[model samples]
Target: MTEPPSLKKEPIGRLISYIHRTQQKRLSRSLSEYGIGGGGQYSFLKGILMTPGTTQDQLTCNLKFDKATTARSVKQLEAAGYIERTTDPEDRRSHRLYPTPKALKFQPVLQAILDEGNAKLTRDLTDEEEDQLIALLQKLNLEE
Candidate 1:
């Protein structure tokens, strides 16, 4: 692909944003059949699957998403039969999330899609380049 003239000196943040938008578009198309949303909804599902009794607040904090986004994702996942939420025994006001049978069965498929998406992102880079890029990106993740 040829770069646009205006992007030659684009800031690192802008470049990262471009990559994120492009990847999200591709991922959304790939995930359309599963009804998993594009805006980090899969992250929420994966998080719940990994930690079966996690709360919305925990997901919000860990995933760096706002409370409303987490709540919406949770609701969507629940509606799609991918997850369930029960009131926490210790705290009635809080709900604990768990993946449903459907989600559990879909776990491997979900992971394969995610893996393919990531692989596509780095397909143009050599192995060493990929490693270096990952390390550099990690460095930019100052808050996490």
Candidate 2:
């Protein structure tokens, strides 16, 4: 048997990429039965559920997603019966997103799925280590 080649150095970027891809795959496979597309769409659903009547543009800004991606997720979730969009009374051109009853029912399950992913990722780390890691990641993200 042959082993795969390893990088010369441990790269944080590579590690982060691997974590993202792996988590996406796991969530997608596990959540398919519930009719929710895995990945960013899940976040979109949760975001809308948390802040109903938020506009797609708002979601784009709040979630740091590109406009196109946010639009697609909103459209898909609407089609899936998870959300509904209403034209903003003050701005006819803008639509506000809201979660449907189906989405409300699914919210807990979606959260549990996310919790499962976090537990899997931090299974080996102590509570202090997890807190430290989160602090460092936040600092890195906030760096300008």
Best by TM-score: 1
TM-score of each: 0.92, 0.90
RMSD of each: 3.9, 4.5
Q: Where is model 2 more than 4 Å wrong at Cα? A: 1-8, 142-144
Write the residue-wise lDDT of candidate 2 on 1-144 in tens digits: 899988688688888889999999999887788887854899899899999999999999899888999988889899999999999999999999999999999999999998998999999999999999998888775433
Candidate achieving the largest lDDT: 1
**Clash-forming residue pairs, model 2:** none
Which lDDT tens digits does candidate 1 get at residues 32-125? 7998987788999999999999999999998899999999999999999999999999999999999999999999999999899999999999
Q: Provide backbone clash counts, one per model.
A: 0, 0
Error of 2 at 117 (Å): 0.8
